[model samples]
Target: MAMAVQGSRHSDFFVEGEVYCDTCRAGFVTNVTTAIQGARVRLECRHYMSASGSVERSAEGTTDATGHYRMELVEVDNRGAELVCAVALLSSPVPECHEMEVGRDRAPVTLVQDVGLATMVRRANPLGFLQTMLARYADTDTRYVDTKMRHL
Candidate 1:
Protein backbone atom coordinates (compact mmCIF):
# COMPACT_ATOMS: atom_id res chain seq x y z
CA MET A 1 0.00 0.00 0.00
CA ALA A 2 1.16 3.56 -0.71
CA MET A 3 1.56 5.85 2.27
CA ALA A 4 0.50 9.51 2.02
CA VAL A 5 3.24 12.04 2.62
CA GLN A 6 2.50 15.36 4.21
CA GLY A 7 3.37 18.40 2.12
CA SER A 8 2.67 22.08 1.80
CA ARG A 9 0.96 23.71 -1.12
CA HIS A 10 3.41 24.94 -3.76
CA SER A 11 2.81 27.79 -6.13
CA ASP A 12 4.48 28.68 -9.42
CA PHE A 13 6.16 32.07 -9.35
CA PHE A 14 8.31 33.89 -11.91
CA VAL A 15 10.89 36.64 -11.38
CA GLU A 16 10.01 39.79 -13.25
CA GLY A 17 13.10 41.00 -15.09
CA GLU A 18 14.43 44.57 -15.05
CA VAL A 19 13.63 47.08 -17.73
CA TYR A 20 16.11 48.61 -20.17
CA CYS A 21 16.44 52.19 -21.31
CA ASP A 22 16.24 52.56 -25.08
CA THR A 23 18.16 55.83 -25.16
CA CYS A 24 20.98 54.44 -23.08
CA ARG A 25 20.41 50.90 -24.34
CA ALA A 26 21.20 49.93 -20.78
CA GLY A 27 19.50 48.12 -17.97
CA PHE A 28 17.12 50.37 -16.06
CA VAL A 29 19.12 49.41 -12.96
CA THR A 30 19.80 52.33 -10.65
CA ASN A 31 23.58 52.45 -10.23
CA VAL A 32 26.93 50.59 -10.39
CA THR A 33 26.74 50.73 -14.17
CA THR A 34 24.10 48.02 -13.99
CA ALA A 35 21.11 47.82 -11.69
CA ILE A 36 20.19 51.16 -10.22
CA GLN A 37 19.82 51.91 -6.56
CA GLY A 38 16.49 53.34 -5.43
CA ALA A 39 15.18 52.83 -8.95
CA ARG A 40 11.54 51.84 -9.52
CA VAL A 41 10.10 49.20 -11.86
CA ARG A 42 6.92 47.25 -12.55
CA LEU A 43 5.66 44.17 -14.41
CA GLU A 44 2.36 43.74 -16.25
CA CYS A 45 1.16 40.53 -17.88
CA ARG A 46 -1.82 39.51 -19.98
CA HIS A 47 -3.01 36.38 -21.71
CA TYR A 48 -2.56 35.96 -25.42
CA MET A 49 -4.20 38.49 -27.74
CA SER A 50 -5.92 38.06 -31.04
CA ALA A 51 -6.03 40.21 -34.13
CA SER A 52 -9.26 41.92 -33.09
CA GLY A 53 -7.55 43.97 -30.39
CA SER A 54 -9.16 42.07 -27.57
CA VAL A 55 -7.53 41.21 -24.21
CA GLU A 56 -7.89 38.74 -21.38
CA ARG A 57 -7.05 38.45 -17.68
CA SER A 58 -3.61 39.92 -16.93
CA ALA A 59 -1.50 40.29 -13.77
CA GLU A 60 1.24 42.74 -12.67
CA GLY A 61 4.26 42.55 -10.31
CA THR A 62 7.42 44.43 -9.11
CA THR A 63 11.11 43.93 -8.48
CA ASP A 64 12.88 43.26 -5.16
CA ALA A 65 16.34 44.03 -3.68
CA THR A 66 18.09 41.93 -6.32
CA GLY A 67 16.24 43.59 -9.18
CA HIS A 68 13.83 40.70 -9.68
CA TYR A 69 10.07 40.64 -9.19
CA ARG A 70 7.79 37.62 -8.89
CA MET A 71 4.30 36.75 -10.12
CA GLU A 72 2.29 33.56 -9.33
CA LEU A 73 -0.87 33.81 -11.39
CA VAL A 74 -0.45 30.59 -13.30
CA GLU A 75 -1.00 27.23 -11.72
CA VAL A 76 -0.11 23.76 -12.94
CA ASP A 77 -3.70 22.80 -12.14
CA ASN A 78 -4.75 25.59 -14.45
CA ARG A 79 -4.21 24.60 -18.04
CA GLY A 80 -0.79 25.50 -19.43
CA ALA A 81 -0.84 28.80 -21.30
CA GLU A 82 1.55 31.57 -22.34
CA LEU A 83 1.96 35.07 -20.90
CA VAL A 84 3.94 38.11 -22.00
CA CYS A 85 6.12 40.78 -20.36
CA ALA A 86 4.79 44.30 -20.53
CA VAL A 87 6.43 47.55 -19.48
CA ALA A 88 9.89 48.47 -18.19
CA LEU A 89 10.70 51.82 -16.72
CA LEU A 90 12.80 53.87 -14.35
CA SER A 91 10.50 53.39 -11.41
CA SER A 92 9.89 56.11 -8.89
CA PRO A 93 9.36 56.48 -5.11
CA VAL A 94 11.90 53.88 -4.02
CA PRO A 95 12.08 52.94 -0.34
CA GLU A 96 14.40 55.86 0.34
CA CYS A 97 12.07 58.11 -1.58
CA HIS A 98 8.56 56.82 -1.21
CA GLU A 99 7.39 59.68 -3.39
CA MET A 100 8.24 60.59 -6.92
CA GLU A 101 11.38 62.73 -7.28
CA VAL A 102 11.89 65.55 -9.70
CA GLY A 103 13.66 64.94 -13.06
CA ARG A 104 12.90 61.22 -13.04
CA ASP A 105 10.62 59.89 -15.78
CA ARG A 106 8.40 56.85 -15.92
CA ALA A 107 9.22 54.97 -19.08
CA PRO A 108 6.55 53.89 -21.52
CA VAL A 109 5.58 50.19 -21.35
CA THR A 110 7.00 47.92 -23.99
CA LEU A 111 5.10 44.64 -24.32
CA VAL A 112 7.04 41.50 -25.18
CA GLN A 113 5.09 38.64 -26.77
CA ASP A 114 7.30 35.66 -25.92
CA VAL A 115 7.47 35.97 -22.10
CA GLY A 116 5.48 32.88 -21.25
CA LEU A 117 5.41 30.38 -18.36
CA ALA A 118 7.80 28.04 -20.15
CA THR A 119 10.86 30.27 -19.83
CA MET A 120 10.87 30.24 -16.02
CA VAL A 121 11.11 27.66 -13.27
CA ARG A 122 8.51 27.70 -10.52
CA ARG A 123 9.64 28.64 -7.01
CA ALA A 124 7.76 28.72 -3.72
CA ASN A 125 8.89 32.32 -3.29
CA PRO A 126 10.93 34.23 -5.83
CA LEU A 127 13.86 36.45 -4.81
CA GLY A 128 15.45 39.43 -6.55
CA PHE A 129 12.62 41.91 -7.15
CA LEU A 130 9.57 42.17 -4.97
CA GLN A 131 6.36 40.71 -6.27
CA THR A 132 4.97 44.21 -6.62
CA MET A 133 6.01 47.74 -5.61
CA LEU A 134 2.44 49.14 -5.41
CA ALA A 135 3.84 52.59 -6.16
CA ARG A 136 1.25 55.34 -6.59
CA TYR A 137 1.46 57.60 -9.61
CA ALA A 138 -0.01 60.88 -10.89
CA ASP A 139 -0.97 62.11 -7.44
CA THR A 140 0.23 65.47 -8.69
CA ASP A 141 -0.59 67.21 -11.93
CA THR A 142 1.26 65.48 -14.76
CA ARG A 143 0.15 65.14 -18.36
CA TYR A 144 0.63 61.98 -20.39
CA VAL A 145 3.02 62.26 -23.30
CA ASP A 146 1.15 63.02 -26.49
CA THR A 147 4.07 61.80 -28.64
CA LYS A 148 7.06 59.44 -28.60
CA MET A 149 10.58 60.66 -27.72
CA ARG A 150 12.19 58.92 -30.71
CA HIS A 151 12.11 62.08 -32.82
CA LEU A 152 13.21 64.33 -29.99
Candidate 2:
Protein backbone atom coordinates (compact mmCIF):
# COMPACT_ATOMS: atom_id res chain seq x y z
CA MET A 1 0.00 0.00 0.00
CA ALA A 2 2.78 2.40 -0.80
CA MET A 3 1.93 5.80 -2.30
CA ALA A 4 3.64 7.37 -5.26
CA VAL A 5 3.47 10.99 -6.32
CA GLN A 6 3.51 11.67 -10.01
CA GLY A 7 3.41 14.81 -12.07
CA SER A 8 1.11 15.27 -15.04
CA ARG A 9 1.35 17.46 -18.08
CA HIS A 10 -1.43 19.62 -16.66
CA SER A 11 0.78 20.55 -13.69
CA ASP A 12 -1.42 18.73 -11.23
CA PHE A 13 -0.03 15.97 -9.04
CA PHE A 14 -1.44 12.49 -8.63
CA VAL A 15 -1.18 10.31 -5.54
CA GLU A 16 -1.81 6.61 -5.71
CA GLY A 17 -1.93 3.78 -3.16
CA GLU A 18 -3.72 0.61 -2.16
CA VAL A 19 -6.05 -0.42 0.67
CA TYR A 20 -6.11 -3.92 2.10
CA CYS A 21 -7.49 -5.91 4.99
CA ASP A 22 -5.04 -7.21 7.55
CA THR A 23 -6.71 -10.55 7.90
CA CYS A 24 -4.30 -11.77 10.58
CA ARG A 25 -3.78 -8.29 12.05
CA ALA A 26 -0.23 -8.32 10.73
CA GLY A 27 1.37 -5.01 9.90
CA PHE A 28 2.35 -6.02 6.38
CA VAL A 29 0.56 -7.95 3.68
CA THR A 30 0.37 -11.70 3.92
CA ASN A 31 -0.62 -14.64 1.77
CA VAL A 32 -4.15 -14.57 3.18
CA THR A 33 -4.54 -10.78 2.93
CA THR A 34 -7.50 -9.38 1.02
CA ALA A 35 -7.99 -6.28 -1.00
CA ILE A 36 -10.65 -3.78 0.08
CA GLN A 37 -12.85 -2.34 -2.59
CA GLY A 38 -14.87 0.85 -2.22
CA ALA A 39 -12.55 2.10 0.49
CA ARG A 40 -12.20 5.86 0.70
CA VAL A 41 -8.73 7.43 0.73
CA ARG A 42 -7.67 11.02 1.07
CA LEU A 43 -4.66 13.11 0.07
CA GLU A 44 -4.13 16.07 2.32
CA CYS A 45 -1.60 18.86 1.98
CA ARG A 46 -0.79 21.63 4.41
CA HIS A 47 1.31 24.67 3.73
CA TYR A 48 2.41 27.51 5.92
CA MET A 49 1.69 30.84 4.30
CA SER A 50 3.60 32.77 6.92
CA ALA A 51 4.81 32.54 10.46
CA SER A 52 1.25 32.92 11.66
CA GLY A 53 -0.76 31.60 8.72
CA SER A 54 -1.33 28.24 7.07
CA VAL A 55 -3.65 26.53 4.62
CA GLU A 56 -4.78 23.02 3.86
CA ARG A 57 -6.07 21.22 0.77
CA SER A 58 -7.43 17.77 0.29
CA ALA A 59 -8.72 15.36 -2.38
CA GLU A 60 -10.62 12.13 -2.03
CA GLY A 61 -10.58 8.88 -3.95
CA THR A 62 -12.08 5.42 -3.74
CA THR A 63 -10.45 2.06 -4.10
CA ASP A 64 -11.28 0.01 -7.15
CA ALA A 65 -11.84 -3.72 -7.30
CA THR A 66 -8.09 -4.20 -6.98
CA GLY A 67 -7.91 -1.96 -3.90
CA HIS A 68 -6.12 0.73 -5.82
CA TYR A 69 -6.92 4.45 -5.48
CA ARG A 70 -5.53 7.54 -7.16
CA MET A 71 -6.25 11.19 -6.42
CA GLU A 72 -5.32 14.32 -8.30
CA LEU A 73 -4.34 17.45 -6.42
CA VAL A 74 -5.23 20.58 -8.35
CA GLU A 75 -5.03 24.30 -7.77
CA VAL A 76 -2.01 23.73 -5.55
CA ASP A 77 0.32 26.65 -5.12
CA ASN A 78 3.46 25.96 -3.21
CA ARG A 79 4.02 29.70 -2.83
CA GLY A 80 7.64 29.15 -1.82
CA ALA A 81 6.46 27.12 1.11
CA GLU A 82 7.03 23.42 1.48
CA LEU A 83 3.75 21.55 1.20
CA VAL A 84 3.51 18.70 3.62
CA CYS A 85 1.46 15.99 1.96
CA ALA A 86 0.13 12.67 3.19
CA VAL A 87 -2.29 9.95 2.13
CA ALA A 88 -4.62 8.60 4.76
CA LEU A 89 -7.46 6.17 5.14
CA LEU A 90 -10.90 7.75 5.33
CA SER A 91 -13.56 5.05 5.36
CA SER A 92 -13.88 1.42 4.44
CA PRO A 93 -16.93 -0.29 3.03
CA VAL A 94 -16.22 -3.57 4.75
CA PRO A 95 -18.08 -3.54 8.05
CA GLU A 96 -15.84 -6.13 9.63
CA CYS A 97 -12.62 -4.37 8.69
CA HIS A 98 -13.46 -0.73 9.23
CA GLU A 99 -11.10 0.07 12.06
CA MET A 100 -8.01 2.03 11.09
CA GLU A 101 -4.64 0.54 12.02
CA VAL A 102 -2.70 2.90 14.25
CA GLY A 103 0.68 4.17 12.94
CA ARG A 104 -0.13 2.69 9.56
CA ASP A 105 -3.18 4.77 8.73
CA ARG A 106 -1.27 7.51 6.97
CA ALA A 107 1.73 7.74 4.62
CA PRO A 108 3.79 10.83 4.00
CA VAL A 109 4.48 11.85 0.40
CA THR A 110 7.10 14.10 -1.06
CA LEU A 111 5.64 16.61 -3.51
CA VAL A 112 8.51 19.01 -3.85
CA GLN A 113 10.00 19.32 -7.33
CA ASP A 114 13.48 20.37 -6.26
CA VAL A 115 14.62 17.06 -4.88
CA GLY A 116 16.86 16.48 -7.93
CA LEU A 117 14.99 13.39 -8.86
CA ALA A 118 14.75 12.25 -12.44
CA THR A 119 11.16 11.09 -12.04
CA MET A 120 8.08 12.28 -10.24
CA VAL A 121 7.26 8.90 -8.85
CA ARG A 122 7.83 8.42 -5.13
CA ARG A 123 7.11 5.41 -2.97
CA ALA A 124 5.50 5.46 0.46
CA ASN A 125 4.07 3.23 3.18
CA PRO A 126 0.73 1.43 3.34
CA LEU A 127 -2.80 1.88 4.80
CA GLY A 128 -5.18 -0.93 5.60
CA PHE A 129 -7.83 -2.29 7.99
CA LEU A 130 -7.77 -5.03 10.57
CA GLN A 131 -10.47 -7.64 10.71
CA THR A 132 -12.84 -6.72 13.52
CA MET A 133 -13.30 -10.22 14.87
CA LEU A 134 -9.89 -11.72 14.05
CA ALA A 135 -11.74 -14.43 12.24
CA ARG A 136 -8.55 -16.42 11.82
CA TYR A 137 -8.34 -16.80 15.56
CA ALA A 138 -11.95 -17.69 16.12
CA ASP A 139 -11.13 -21.31 16.70
CA THR A 140 -8.08 -20.76 18.83
CA ASP A 141 -8.35 -20.80 22.63
CA THR A 142 -4.70 -20.01 23.23
CA ARG A 143 -5.02 -16.28 23.72
CA TYR A 144 -8.55 -15.17 22.94
CA VAL A 145 -10.98 -17.05 25.15
CA ASP A 146 -13.86 -14.68 24.45
CA THR A 147 -13.45 -14.94 20.71
CA LYS A 148 -13.12 -18.71 20.86
CA MET A 149 -16.29 -18.86 22.94
CA ARG A 150 -18.21 -16.95 20.33
CA HIS A 151 -17.11 -19.36 17.63
CA LEU A 152 -17.94 -22.41 19.75
Candidate 3:
Protein backbone atom coordinates (compact mmCIF):
# COMPACT_ATOMS: atom_id res chain seq x y z
CA MET A 1 0.00 0.00 0.00
CA ALA A 2 1.17 3.52 -0.86
CA MET A 3 0.08 6.85 0.61
CA ALA A 4 -0.22 10.23 -1.07
CA VAL A 5 -0.20 13.70 0.48
CA GLN A 6 -1.76 16.91 -0.75
CA GLY A 7 -0.86 20.49 0.05
CA SER A 8 -2.58 23.83 -0.26
CA ARG A 9 -1.99 26.14 -3.19
CA HIS A 10 -1.54 29.89 -3.32
CA SER A 11 -2.16 32.08 -6.33
CA ASP A 12 -0.35 35.23 -5.24
CA PHE A 13 1.86 36.84 -2.64
CA PHE A 14 2.04 40.37 -1.25
CA VAL A 15 5.07 42.22 0.12
CA GLU A 16 4.73 45.23 2.38
CA GLY A 17 7.38 47.47 3.91
CA GLU A 18 8.30 50.96 5.06
CA VAL A 19 11.12 53.43 4.44
CA TYR A 20 12.57 55.88 6.92
CA CYS A 21 15.46 58.20 7.62
CA ASP A 22 17.88 57.33 10.43
CA THR A 23 17.90 60.68 12.19
CA CYS A 24 20.59 59.76 14.71
CA ARG A 25 22.54 57.60 12.25
CA ALA A 26 21.66 54.64 14.43
CA GLY A 27 21.72 52.34 11.38
CA PHE A 28 18.19 51.15 11.99
CA VAL A 29 14.69 52.50 12.08
CA THR A 30 13.42 53.79 15.40
CA ASN A 31 10.37 55.58 16.75
CA VAL A 32 12.22 58.87 16.64
CA THR A 33 13.06 58.34 12.97
CA THR A 34 10.85 60.08 10.44
CA ALA A 35 9.28 58.50 7.40
CA ILE A 36 10.67 59.55 4.04
CA GLN A 37 8.08 60.80 1.64
CA GLY A 38 8.34 60.40 -2.13
CA ALA A 39 10.89 57.64 -1.85
CA ARG A 40 11.13 55.12 -4.67
CA VAL A 41 11.10 51.37 -4.01
CA ARG A 42 11.16 48.38 -6.32
CA LEU A 43 10.49 44.66 -6.27
CA GLU A 44 12.68 42.59 -8.55
CA CYS A 45 12.56 38.95 -9.53
CA ARG A 46 15.46 37.22 -11.28
CA HIS A 47 15.82 33.75 -12.66
CA TYR A 48 19.10 31.86 -12.99
CA MET A 49 19.13 30.89 -16.65
CA SER A 50 17.46 33.58 -18.70
CA ALA A 51 18.51 34.51 -22.21
CA SER A 52 17.81 38.17 -21.61
CA GLY A 53 19.97 38.21 -18.45
CA SER A 54 17.69 40.86 -16.93
CA VAL A 55 15.08 41.02 -14.32
CA GLU A 56 12.25 38.66 -15.11
CA ARG A 57 9.57 40.82 -13.51
CA SER A 58 9.62 44.09 -11.65
CA ALA A 59 7.14 46.42 -9.95
CA GLU A 60 7.72 49.83 -8.45
CA GLY A 61 5.79 52.08 -6.06
CA THR A 62 6.50 55.29 -4.24
CA THR A 63 6.13 55.88 -0.57
CA ASP A 64 3.13 57.80 0.67
CA ALA A 65 3.02 60.52 3.31
CA THR A 66 3.44 57.82 5.94
CA GLY A 67 6.30 56.13 4.04
CA HIS A 68 4.49 52.85 3.58
CA TYR A 69 4.49 50.78 0.37
CA ARG A 70 2.82 47.59 -0.75
CA MET A 71 3.61 45.50 -3.83
CA GLU A 72 1.69 42.54 -5.15
CA LEU A 73 3.56 39.80 -7.02
CA VAL A 74 2.03 37.16 -9.18
CA GLU A 75 2.98 33.58 -8.43
CA VAL A 76 5.51 32.44 -10.98
CA ASP A 77 6.02 28.86 -12.02
CA ASN A 78 9.77 28.36 -12.47
CA ARG A 79 9.51 24.67 -13.35
CA GLY A 80 11.48 23.40 -10.31
CA ALA A 81 14.02 26.21 -10.32
CA GLU A 82 14.50 28.86 -7.63
CA LEU A 83 13.31 32.38 -8.23
CA VAL A 84 15.05 35.21 -6.39
CA CYS A 85 13.02 38.14 -5.16
CA ALA A 86 13.97 41.21 -3.16
CA VAL A 87 12.72 44.64 -2.12
CA ALA A 88 15.25 47.37 -2.68
CA LEU A 89 15.48 51.12 -2.11
CA LEU A 90 15.87 53.22 -5.22
CA SER A 91 15.89 56.92 -4.38
CA SER A 92 14.92 59.48 -1.81
CA PRO A 93 13.61 62.99 -2.29
CA VAL A 94 15.24 64.24 0.88
CA PRO A 95 18.76 65.28 -0.03
CA GLU A 96 19.97 65.11 3.54
CA CYS A 97 19.13 61.42 3.74
CA HIS A 98 19.99 60.17 0.30
CA GLU A 99 22.95 57.97 1.23
CA MET A 100 22.13 54.29 1.29
CA GLU A 101 23.35 52.20 4.18
CA VAL A 102 25.32 48.98 3.63
CA GLY A 103 22.95 46.22 4.68
CA ARG A 104 19.73 48.19 4.63
CA ASP A 105 19.63 48.74 0.93
CA ARG A 106 17.91 45.55 -0.11
CA ALA A 107 15.91 42.91 1.68
CA PRO A 108 15.44 39.41 0.30
CA VAL A 109 12.09 37.71 0.60
CA THR A 110 10.61 34.34 -0.28
CA LEU A 111 7.90 34.62 -2.91
CA VAL A 112 7.34 31.01 -3.83
CA GLN A 113 6.02 28.36 -1.54
CA ASP A 114 4.26 25.03 -1.74
CA VAL A 115 2.48 25.02 1.59
CA GLY A 116 -1.28 25.09 1.80
CA LEU A 117 -2.59 28.62 1.86
CA ALA A 118 -4.93 30.76 -0.17
CA THR A 119 -2.88 33.95 -0.04
CA MET A 120 0.40 34.82 1.67
CA VAL A 121 1.50 38.24 2.78
CA ARG A 122 5.14 38.82 3.74
CA ARG A 123 6.18 41.85 5.78
CA ALA A 124 9.69 43.03 5.04
CA ASN A 125 11.90 44.83 7.52
CA PRO A 126 12.19 48.59 7.39
CA LEU A 127 14.89 49.99 5.10
CA GLY A 128 16.57 53.29 5.86
CA PHE A 129 19.38 55.71 4.93
CA LEU A 130 21.77 57.83 6.95
CA GLN A 131 20.93 61.48 7.35
CA THR A 132 23.49 64.15 6.56
CA MET A 133 25.07 65.98 9.44
CA LEU A 134 23.65 69.37 10.35
CA ALA A 135 25.77 72.43 11.00
CA ARG A 136 24.69 72.97 14.60
CA TYR A 137 24.19 69.40 15.73
CA ALA A 138 26.48 68.00 18.44
CA ASP A 139 26.78 64.87 20.51
CA THR A 140 26.18 64.93 24.23
CA ASP A 141 29.28 65.34 26.45
CA THR A 142 30.45 62.20 28.23
CA ARG A 143 33.62 63.45 29.97
CA TYR A 144 33.98 63.11 33.72
CA VAL A 145 36.26 64.90 36.20
CA ASP A 146 37.42 63.82 39.65
CA THR A 147 36.62 66.31 42.41
CA LYS A 148 39.52 65.08 44.62
CA MET A 149 42.09 65.68 41.84
CA ARG A 150 40.94 69.24 41.50
CA HIS A 151 41.58 69.85 45.22
CA LEU A 152 45.10 68.30 44.97
Candidate 4:
Protein backbone atom coordinates (compact mmCIF):
# COMPACT_ATOMS: atom_id res chain seq x y z
CA MET A 1 0.00 0.00 0.00
CA ALA A 2 3.00 2.28 -0.07
CA MET A 3 2.39 4.84 -2.85
CA ALA A 4 5.37 5.87 -4.94
CA VAL A 5 4.76 9.10 -6.83
CA GLN A 6 7.15 9.59 -9.70
CA GLY A 7 7.60 12.53 -12.08
CA SER A 8 8.33 11.60 -15.66
CA ARG A 9 10.48 13.59 -18.07
CA HIS A 10 7.44 15.11 -19.74
CA SER A 11 6.02 16.43 -16.45
CA ASP A 12 3.50 13.60 -16.24
CA PHE A 13 3.21 12.01 -12.82
CA PHE A 14 2.70 8.38 -11.87
CA VAL A 15 0.92 7.13 -8.83
CA GLU A 16 2.07 3.62 -8.01
CA GLY A 17 1.07 1.32 -5.18
CA GLU A 18 0.12 -2.22 -4.22
CA VAL A 19 -3.00 -3.57 -2.53
CA TYR A 20 -3.02 -6.32 0.09
CA CYS A 21 -5.42 -8.07 2.43
CA ASP A 22 -4.75 -8.16 6.16
CA THR A 23 -5.39 -11.86 6.72
CA CYS A 24 -4.36 -11.68 10.38
CA ARG A 25 -6.83 -8.84 11.10
CA ALA A 26 -3.96 -6.81 12.52
CA GLY A 27 -4.75 -3.69 10.47
CA PHE A 28 -1.36 -4.03 8.83
CA VAL A 29 0.41 -6.40 6.50
CA THR A 30 1.90 -9.51 8.05
CA ASN A 31 4.10 -12.32 6.82
CA VAL A 32 1.07 -14.44 5.93
CA THR A 33 -0.83 -11.67 4.20
CA THR A 34 -1.81 -12.09 0.54
CA ALA A 35 -1.94 -9.64 -2.31
CA ILE A 36 -5.37 -8.56 -3.53
CA GLN A 37 -5.68 -8.85 -7.25
CA GLY A 38 -8.25 -6.80 -9.19
CA ALA A 39 -8.54 -4.41 -6.31
CA ARG A 40 -9.30 -0.77 -7.07
CA VAL A 41 -7.34 2.24 -5.88
CA ARG A 42 -7.75 5.99 -6.27
CA LEU A 43 -5.50 9.02 -6.16
CA GLU A 44 -6.96 12.41 -5.27
CA CYS A 45 -5.11 15.69 -5.26
CA ARG A 46 -5.81 19.37 -4.70
CA HIS A 47 -3.45 22.07 -5.85
CA TYR A 48 -3.62 25.52 -4.31
CA MET A 49 -1.89 27.82 -6.71
CA SER A 50 -2.91 31.00 -4.99
CA ALA A 51 -5.35 32.33 -2.41
CA SER A 52 -8.00 33.00 -5.02
CA GLY A 53 -8.61 29.51 -6.37
CA SER A 54 -7.55 25.84 -6.31
CA VAL A 55 -7.54 22.93 -8.70
CA GLU A 56 -8.61 19.34 -8.10
CA ARG A 57 -7.30 16.24 -9.79
CA SER A 58 -8.07 12.55 -9.51
CA ALA A 59 -7.14 9.23 -11.14
CA GLU A 60 -8.18 5.59 -10.68
CA GLY A 61 -6.46 2.29 -11.28
CA THR A 62 -6.94 -1.43 -10.77
CA THR A 63 -4.43 -3.79 -9.25
CA ASP A 64 -2.92 -6.44 -11.48
CA ALA A 65 -2.40 -10.11 -10.72
CA THR A 66 0.55 -9.19 -8.52
CA GLY A 67 -1.50 -6.47 -6.72
CA HIS A 68 0.36 -3.58 -8.29
CA TYR A 69 -1.18 -0.50 -9.95
CA ARG A 70 0.19 2.64 -11.56
CA MET A 71 -1.98 5.60 -12.47
CA GLU A 72 -0.81 8.38 -14.72
CA LEU A 73 -1.55 12.10 -14.37
CA VAL A 74 -0.71 13.89 -17.58
CA GLU A 75 0.58 17.45 -17.81
CA VAL A 76 0.46 18.06 -14.08
CA ASP A 77 2.60 21.05 -13.25
CA ASN A 78 2.56 21.26 -9.46
CA ARG A 79 5.76 23.20 -9.09
CA GLY A 80 5.59 26.39 -6.97
CA ALA A 81 2.20 25.30 -5.75
CA GLU A 82 0.88 23.60 -2.65
CA LEU A 83 -0.13 20.08 -3.61
CA VAL A 84 -2.03 17.82 -1.24
CA CYS A 85 -2.59 14.27 -2.40
CA ALA A 86 -3.81 11.01 -0.93
CA VAL A 87 -4.19 7.43 -2.09
CA ALA A 88 -7.18 5.44 -0.85
CA LEU A 89 -8.64 1.97 -1.18
CA LEU A 90 -11.62 1.79 -3.50
CA SER A 91 -12.66 -1.87 -3.48
CA SER A 92 -11.34 -5.35 -2.87
CA PRO A 93 -11.92 -8.45 -4.96
CA VAL A 94 -11.96 -10.72 -1.91
CA PRO A 95 -15.30 -10.55 -0.15
CA GLU A 96 -13.95 -11.61 3.22
CA CYS A 97 -11.25 -8.99 3.15
CA HIS A 98 -13.29 -5.98 2.12
CA GLU A 99 -13.21 -4.15 5.40
CA MET A 100 -11.24 -0.97 5.17
CA GLU A 101 -8.72 -0.42 7.92
CA VAL A 102 -9.71 2.46 10.23
CA GLY A 103 -6.69 4.70 10.02
CA ARG A 104 -4.71 2.98 7.30
CA ASP A 105 -7.30 3.26 4.60
CA ARG A 106 -5.88 6.49 3.12
CA ALA A 107 -2.21 7.37 2.72
CA PRO A 108 -0.98 10.93 2.30
CA VAL A 109 1.62 11.66 -0.36
CA THR A 110 3.81 14.62 -1.27
CA LEU A 111 3.98 15.29 -5.01
CA VAL A 112 6.05 18.45 -5.05
CA GLN A 113 9.79 18.21 -5.68
CA ASP A 114 10.80 20.90 -3.22
CA VAL A 115 11.18 18.52 -0.28
CA GLY A 116 14.86 17.94 -0.97
CA LEU A 117 14.26 14.46 -2.35
CA ALA A 118 17.30 13.17 -4.16
CA THR A 119 15.20 11.59 -6.89
CA MET A 120 11.94 12.34 -8.62
CA VAL A 121 10.14 9.64 -6.61
CA ARG A 122 8.17 10.38 -3.47
CA ARG A 123 6.87 7.54 -1.33
CA ALA A 124 3.94 7.55 1.04
CA ASN A 125 3.07 5.31 3.97
CA PRO A 126 1.29 2.00 3.59
CA LEU A 127 -2.46 1.58 3.21
CA GLY A 128 -4.38 -1.63 3.86
CA PHE A 129 -7.71 -3.41 4.31
CA LEU A 130 -8.71 -5.93 6.94
CA GLN A 131 -10.78 -9.09 6.87
CA THR A 132 -14.42 -8.68 7.68
CA MET A 133 -15.14 -8.98 11.36
CA LEU A 134 -17.41 -11.80 12.50
CA ALA A 135 -19.13 -12.48 15.77
CA ARG A 136 -21.25 -15.31 17.14
CA TYR A 137 -24.67 -14.53 18.53
CA ALA A 138 -25.45 -15.21 22.17
CA ASP A 139 -28.44 -17.42 21.27
CA THR A 140 -28.43 -21.16 21.14
CA ASP A 141 -27.90 -21.36 17.41
CA THR A 142 -24.22 -20.80 16.66
CA ARG A 143 -23.86 -18.73 13.55
CA TYR A 144 -21.38 -16.04 12.77
CA VAL A 145 -22.76 -12.72 11.60
CA ASP A 146 -21.05 -9.77 10.00
CA THR A 147 -20.02 -7.11 12.50
CA LYS A 148 -19.38 -4.41 9.98
CA MET A 149 -21.54 -1.75 11.64
CA ARG A 150 -20.12 -2.45 15.07
CA HIS A 151 -17.25 -0.18 15.94
CA LEU A 152 -14.27 -2.19 17.05
lDDT of the structure predicted as candidate 2? 0.75
Q: What is the C-alpha lDDT of each candidate?
A: 0.35, 0.75, 0.75, 0.70
Expressed as tens digits, the lDDT of each residue in 1-152 for candidate 3 is 12322222244567889999888788887777999999999988777677676887777878899989888776556431466778999999998888898799888876755554345777778889778655114343322223322553
How far off is residue 11 in model 3, in Å? Answer: 1.9
Query: Clashes in each model (backbone N, CA, C under 3 Å)?
Result: 14, 0, 1, 0
TM-score of predicted model 3? 0.72
| TM-score, per-candidate, Cα-based | 0.36, 0.75, 0.72, 0.72
lDDT for position 74 in model 4: 71
Candidate 4 global TM-score: 0.72
Instruction: Give candidate 3 regions above 4 Å deviation.
Output: 1-10, 48-53, 78-81, 115-118, 135-152
Question: For candidate 1, what is the total of clashing residue pairs?
Answer: 14
Query: lDDT tens string, model 1, 1-152?
Result: 12322112223344344422222322233332223334444444444554543434334555545445444444332322444434334453334223332323232222322345444443222112221112222232333222222334
Give the C-alpha lDDT of model 4.
0.70
